[model samples]
Target: MRSAYSVETVRAAERELMARLPEGALMQRAASGLAAACAELLGRVYGSRVVLLVGSGDNGGDALYAGARLARRGAGVTALLLAPERTHPGGLAALRAAGGSAREAAGGALDGRAAEDGAVAAGVAELIRRADLVVDGIVGIGGSGGLRPAAVPLAVLARASDAVVVAVDLPSGVEADSGEVRGEAVRADATVTFGTHKPGLLIDPAREYAGATRLVDIGLRPHLPPTADLEALQHADVAALLPSPAAESDKYRRGVVGVAAGSARYPGAAVLAVSGALHGGAGAVRYVGPAGDAVIARFPETLVSAGPPSKAGRVQAWVVGPGVGDDAGVVDEVLASDVPVLVDADGLRLADRAAVRARTAPTLLTPHAGEAAALLGTSREEVEAARLPAVRELAARYGATALLKGSTTLVAGPDGGPVRVNPTGTPWLATAGSGDVLSGLAGSLLAGGLDALDAASVAAYLHGLAGRVAAGEGAPVGASEVAATVARVWRDVVGGGWAAPSAGY
Candidate 1:
């Protein structure tokens, strides 16, 4: 599992470790790691033109020292200081001592004098354009909002260049704690993060700004706490959570999932949900809805029922609200049950807040950005911009585990532990009926004896991998294809022979 801590926690851990080490030892360690990453990105450091966007504080210090190391190795390093007076004295001296050049940025004060506007802009642009690599050290983890006005042009120029842009600790101008990009930010080809992962690196929309994140060990692990603010399950971590039947296991013993979905107008939703449930861990799927014929035609093994959910027979768990439009009564009956229930799609709107909060059994709420916005009385744009807060608030309000589905799937439990961020997923998962399939898969896991948190987390992990398999090489796939591919991924995961496809972080 990849764990992420909050900015405050990371700073505390860093401070504790720095107290035990020599005065300049911690900064030296960070500088060495940063330099090594920049060198690798350049392919050959010798004779390479390297440019560093230097700001005030330690973030700028890291880049300056790193540029000094590169200069010592025969690289042509230039430090573009955004704040000359406030720059780290030690770092600036080291760069010059190593034969690296330093100059104030265009538009910045130069020796108590300001240069011509056009000439300064051209100079800045030329430096970034000719460089082989541009290192972003304009902001650090403690910085919030977007890049300052003085540094925005540098970020813009770097983006327009052909150089491989690498961020020092995190991409400049992104919120390190909330993963929100309120204003303009740097877009890096890669980011070198030190010690533990920050929440911003794992969550989006800040995650999208940070390219491929590489963690460099600065030895801050021992001082960090055990519990993390966020966690991403790896292949081995998810494999151990998978359910497998014993020799004495039977159909009933394995568990049965009851799916109450579909309407007279939209019967396909029921079929799709049932299709996913059949392949899920549940041995038998008992479906109770108006789409009984469509489901039976598609999956002959499904147990179908009519009318109220009370007569749906014995089911260990229930999945409600795929496409049962305006059927609030059935949702109420299912929510009244003692078993774990997963509420999604139309159900998210139909499920009563008082009833959901009153339930003693586990309840999982799955909502996309639009649905979540409606539930929270906010706009879709707001929820999408700040997914972490939205998901956590949903869980706390309804007193149920909330799964916010998107490019990065997040599962937050009602009681507030580390929110699980799903690392596996392709953009192709944005197709229709994807949420219905996910609802079924998670419900089956619940019936298979996994808790609400684990069920949601494990289901998301498999669902993402299955999406990748169905859409091999970035081809388009329907929801049915994703459902059919679940078993294949399950087998591969259990056998420890699966490979994840390419996806944007």
Candidate 2:
């Protein structure tokens, strides 16, 4: 699994590690790694033209020092210092000593500089246009909101240029912690980050700005905590979390998932939900709803029940909602049970918030942006824009594990721990009955003894993989087709001869 820490946590770790090392030791280590990454990207750095957009922080120092390294290696390097006097003195000297050219964009002091309004703008644009690589050191993790006016045109030129833009630490103008890009931000082709991965590097908006991240360790590992602020599960991690049936285990010993979904009008939802549960390692699926006949028609093995959840026989876990519109009674009945309950679709609207919080058993709430927005009293666009905070707040408010489904699926628990960002999902999965399928799969995993967070995260991971498999070559796939591939994805995840490295860090 790949993990990410908050900016505060990462800075604390950096400070702790920096205290033990000699002055400038950490910066040099970062510069060395950053320079190496640039060299790798350039392939043949010899006689290459590299431009360093130096600012007024240590990030600028890193870029300058990296430029110095490239200069020594026969690359024609130039530094555009937006803050000439404030730029790292030692780094600037090192670059000049190594045959790197340095030019000042600002006429006077930074605060009073008239650079952006002067002829320097033209020079800056020209240098960026002809560069082999443009190193962005305009801002660091501490900077927020967006790029300063002075760096706007340069950012645009770098992005439009043929030069490979490598952001030092993070791209300028992005919230390193929240991943919010309020204004114009440098869109880097790649980012070279030191110590540990920042939340922004792993999240959207900012993550989208950071084309690809290359980590360069400087012995900050020992200082970081055991748990992270966020985690993205890889294939190996999912494989380990997957449940394996014991040799002596019977069908009853494995698990029984109760799916209380569908109604007279939407019987297809029940069939789709049951279809997912069937392949989710559950020993049996007990269906209790008005669509019982429809479910049995689709899957003959399902244990159909015409009555409520109380008469659905014994089940390790229950999956409620997914087309049971206005069925508050069924939701209440399931919430009162001691077994784990997964609420989705219509159940999200019907269930009482107090009852969900009061339940002693594990409760997993799966909400799409629309459902999540309704629960939070916000708009769907707001929830989609601020997914990390929305998911965390939903989990905290409901006192249950919350899975906020979107382009990026996140799972958060009641305790406010690291949110799991699902790395596997296809746009083709965005079809009718997808969430129903997810709910049933997750409920089955819960019955199989996984915790709410694990069940949801693993379910999303598999659900997404199945969607990709079902929609091969970018074709549109139906929800049933995605569900049909669940077992295939589950098998692949658990070392079934066909597995690739998971998507992101």
Best by TM-score: 1
Query: All candidates: CA RMSD in angstroms?
Result: 2.1, 2.1
Off by over 4 Å in 2: 105-120, 496-505
Question: How many angstroms is residue 67 displaced in model 1 relative to the true structure, after the best TM-score fit?
Answer: 1.3
Overall lDDT per candidate, in order of appearance: 0.90, 0.89
Write out the backbone clash pairs for model 2: none
| Residue 232 shift from truth in candidate 2, angstroms | 1.6
Q: Count the backbone clashes (under 3 Å) in each candidate.
A: 0, 0
**Per-residue error at 364 for model 1, in Å?**
0.3
Per-residue lDDT of candidate 1, residues 428-475 (tens digit): 989989888989999998888899999999999999999998999999
TM-score of each: 0.97, 0.94
